[model samples]
Target: MTRKASGAPGQDGHDDLQRNLTNRHIQLIAIGGAIGTGLFMGSGKTISLAGPSIVFVYMAIGIMLFFVMRAMGELLLSNLQYRSFIDFSADLLGPWAGFFTGWTYWFCWIVTGIADVIAITGYAQFWFPDIPQWLPAIACVLVLLGLNLLTVKLFGETEFWFAMIKIVAIVTLIGVGLCMVFSGFVSPAGRQASLANLWNDGGMFPNGLMGFFAGFQIAVFAFVGIELVGTTAAEAKDPERTLPRAINSIPVRIIVFYVLALVAIMAVTPWRDVVPGKSPFVELFVLAGLPAAAGVINFVVLTSAASSANSGVFSTSRMLYGLSLKGDAPKSFGTLSSRSVPSRGLMFSCICLLAGAFLMWMIPDLMEAFTLVTTVSAILFMFVWSLILLSYIAYRRQRAALHQASRFKMPGGVPMCVACLAFFAGILVLLTLKDDTRQALIVTPLWFVLLGVAYQFVRRRAVAGVVAIQ
Candidate 1:
């Protein structure tokens, strides 16, 4: 199939972003986004906090985000010229919506990148206990930066393999875990593996309602990048075909990768026995008397962290590229390199990622640092998702013809959009119930305040430029 250029020509006569990502790239990118570093590293903490009820936490978030992706898919397909949700948001809502959504989305990934960096450092400690945590963190940032600087297609290929690793590890975990349950495998801790382990200890809601609420604090982080395919609309080959295929598979991915994997881990290890600081995936393999397999699981999870960071780097640069085109960001960000990648934005994001190493240096406790950053990332992501829903609502109102015409119309339309918004608000209220999350929540508004100020300045400068030109 012949592909058309998705971006306009720049001063140097190079296309903005090439349509080099095929259906396979989009499919794997969706999978990579569905399974995140939080699932591999933070799920242990979630299980420890919410016990078996953490399953429900993940299911609820996944279902809501599936709807968000549906809304995004429909909007992106409504107009092929729309580079991403940011473009539609600007058109359907206003310029401010685009500016806020664009920059906020960029910040979301930067913060998420930091969390992934911290996760990579923690996962590295699992293999090399004596190594400095900051070393691995900085090394990962540099490696991903180089790969991303080469080409957008290379970024897609890199994510394809990274995501494949996560898929194999999760499938292996679920399969091995089920075998142990069926064979009545006994662990070194004298616990027999069984499906009943889910509730046999203290029932599914072992820690009660508050425990269930606490689960959202980190479980939301696991779904941070679920809407990432929305960001690839500009570069995805035959987006109308690939985007829907990718979005439609989300439910299955969540059921298998998240719900089933967690079920398997809990069945083997039991909720109470799972260590909050260590990955339950590695722990499950160790309990199965395969220390070698446990080491392999550790490596898989380290790669998972790298995958999430890689997505963060890719999306943030693209978002900056979008923002700069609209004059919401500096013009330098809008320029593409000779390779057709956003090298300037890539470098900026990588420098921000190095702060992860600095964070590790400042906060010696890995989990503590991870929780704080992931919480902040989650909150900012919620804002971006909310804007997507809001844009959908506006689209439905103003462009009813577009809605009726869309082959990929959002299921349930505006009602579902409002419901999802309510669900997000509930999660925010839940965030206030804990000290760690509440601390992050309290500081989140400061981001919006800063954005408000910056928007005014940008608007004035844009008006002045037009006046000067006239």
Candidate 2:
């Protein structure tokens, strides 16, 4: 799997991206990536689906994905020349691996970005009911685009603060929740807050095996951007130090944010009473007698959605720039602004995000549109994670000397990669059993088929142009 150091023309010793992302920026970016709108808005649905068992679901996904990130970290640090998993995939597997992984990751972010835009519109409606939904969606895209086009440092700063807000909100919620539980706080519905709520009604697996399985599809979607730190490898100031610290904190983030937050919500409200399609965080605050809960949660959720969309634009643009440099995308996408930003690629991704706003205008039922797109996004993200694992397997085999000599090697190596892959396959099977997820699962393959067709055309043009140059 080893390739020439050049890998390909225009790809060797030619990174235009600035390493302005300091240790703080990288850590926060990774933290921001882990905490998205999913926990704020999607947890209710998961709670409704799997009850208290959802805690275990979040933990399982987090643990498995940590291994995926470990593999990604090892690959990125193996050669300072590699930027992200996309680069190493191309170097270790072939150019096709880079093309497919890069484009698929871009698509994944696009889908997520669109969903976030639609969510922004909905959140705005809470404050300005008469305002048209598409306006806010469009406005959100424009603002993020403007900021991203300026400099990579600004993007990092924006995420740092956005992630800070989310962290503060969750910590506050947990603290308030613990008080409610200890004080025996009683809600308007007459239920008393207690840890016993976890098992009182029907136990953890309240809905049984099928119900537990139902949680996986949505739960997988909740952790969509967990691997986003990989994309910042090109711009991170200290990839070896910061990257490992960020990746190592996954377990703590999972426990603090997802597990404890959900535990708090259920402890106050009970699994059976948790409403579907509504944010449990808001509900907990309200149940705890916070008059400003609605306004506060609305503001927090709005920021969470915006943060996700901002991340999408940053990651997808970088991916396009990477692809272009490899000759897998248009040459123009490789151009950089004076600030070392991929301005053209950023604009291109923002233009695609406009399609999301268009969908909000066209689809009367915004939630339905969000559901379909998010499911597809989840499926596409799974493919990207699988590629990282597969690439790790290849890296271990083909670059055994590097693997043995490296200080930041993946803990479990080949066997761990295989286990994570199997776990992901199990989630796919779970998706098939649910009607909503099944539809997306069926639609997901078409994306790969399209990528395959596009790859052939690109490869053909490369070969023909080379022959002509000769």
- Give per-residue CA lDDT, model 1, range 51-96, as digits (tens): 9999999999999999999999999998887888899999999999
Per-model CA lDDT versus the true structure: 0.89, 0.90
Which 10 consecutive positions of candidate 1 have the poorest summed lDDT?
A: 1-10
Lowest lDDT 10-mer window, candidate 2?
1-10
Q: What would the per-residue lDDT of candidate 2 be over residues 1-470, giving only the tens digit for each residue?
A: 11112223344343668788999999988988888788888899999999999999999999999999999999999988787888999988899999999999999999999899888888999999999767898789999999999989999999999999999999999999999999999998899999999999899999998888888888888888989899999888888899999999988999999999999999999999988978899889888778999999999999999999999999999999889888899887888777888888999999999976685568887677778889999889999999999999999889999998899988988999999999999999998887777888898999999999999999999999999999
For all predictions, the C-alpha RMSD in Å is 3.2, 3.4
Runs of candidate 2 exceeding 4 Å displacement: 1-14
Q: What local lDDT does model 1 show for residue 387? A: 96
Clashing pairs in 2: none
